[model samples]
Target: MFNKILVGIDRSLISKKVFEVALSFATATGANLMLVQVLSDREEDYPQLPAYSYYPMWDDQTVRIYQQQWEEYKKQGIEILNNLAQQATEAGIATEFTQMSGSPERSICQIAYTWNADLIIVGNRGLTGIKEMVLGSVSNYVTHHAPCSVLIVRDTELLPPQSTSE
Candidate 1:
């Protein structure tokens, strides 16, 4: 029986479905839920890539722009996490939230392990083949690396549509 459920969420279309599944499990087991969202800076994350490589030349303006964009992303992530936490609270589930900054897979797994989570609920974006290879799969990474059990909710919409003619 799960006593501590950690749910990783983002601005993805499948986030709502993922939350619903995690909420149901938490409610059934009376488990404490922890909602986590990662706010990563693309420039900082891939520092190996020179900033001037993406532009004609490196300039203060470019740095400022990148900093502003990163701040916006962080703010949006916090708002989403806050909303999710409020929803969970209203549903009578004991909940807390953390906004982390780093690789999604690493942050999620680290939090789960440090928090002593009994389970981790996450959504699979269903990337495959070339895309999966290029971008890597967060759910797959978590499944392999997490210290606790992981439940990856596949979005129903990701499936091929059924034919009406049938």
Candidate 2:
């Protein structure tokens, strides 16, 4: 039985499924749950704000606007984690949540190791081919590099079509 379970969550819809599975497992096994949310400045992630560039070519107003939006994104991320943590805590489970900024793939594994987790749970984005290569799969990376056992949860809607043989 796992004593410490670390769950990697994001703002994506599939994260709900991941957290649900993790919470169920933790409750069943009486394991403490740690929720980790990694935020990235990837343009696609914060499409509401103008993309920040490596080189500076923005007016003061644009920079200020981008900074404000970035702060709001971080606040939202923490709020999500807080609410999820409260849910598990209310269920009488020892739960802790964290918010970090960096590469999701690396951050997830790092937290798993630092927390000495017995199992790491994460969601699969179902990315494939060019999309996977370009975006890089966080679940794939965690599956390979996690310090402990890794559980990858895939959303039902993203499952591959099944073939039937008569």
Candidate 3:
């Protein structure tokens, strides 16, 4: 009975699983799916300066580099979201893709709540304990903070490999 479903995707191996599971569920329920990707603002990464610096002239070069990096990140993030939207369309599901600049978990949760999603699907670290902890799993955060129900699709749990012995 999910009317609005939100799936959080990132450039990771687990994202494919998230996409599949979210798409299937949305299809089954005849729900509208929203794919959200976050691109952090580059300016946030650098320290803020209270006063303008002109003597050393280091600020201009630093700002230029940051701008370039941010542009690249934004471009890549948009391409990814566009592809995801296309894939969902190919699956005959209603979809919308968005690229926002903010914390990943915060952006996802905000969108889910704003859209009033019945369920939010995300990917786990594919049965890896150490990696999950070290990377600070986004799915874990979304599951805990989302306003609605959350489904975590672990890559390893999705489809087990066929027996080689056969």
* lDDT values for all models: 0.85, 0.87, 0.79
- C-alpha positional error of residue 28 in candidate 1 after TM-score superposition, expressed in Å: 1.4
After superposition, candidate 1 runs with Cα above 4 Å error: 40-56, 161-166
The regions of model 3 sitting more than 4 angstroms off are 40-59, 126-135, 157-166
Clashing pairs in 2: none
Give the C-alpha miss distance for residue 15 in model 3, angstroms.
0.6
Question: Which candidate, 1 or 2, would have the higher lDDT against the true structure?
Answer: 2
TM-score of each: 0.85, 0.93, 0.75
| Model 2 spans > 4 angstroms off | 47-54
Q: Give the winner by TM-score.
A: 2
Quality of model 3 by C-alpha lDDT: 0.79
**If the candidates were sorted by their lDDT against the true structure, best first, what order would they fall in?**
2, 1, 3
Give candidate 3's error at residue 141 in angstroms. 2.2
**Local accuracy of candidate 2 as per-residue lDDT tens digits, 1-166:** 7999999888888999999999999899999999998887542566354556434667788778778888888898889999999999998899998988889989989988999999999998788899899889998989999999999998878889999999
Q: Evaluate residue 40 in candidate 1 and report its C-alpha lDDT on the 0 to 100 scale.
A: 45
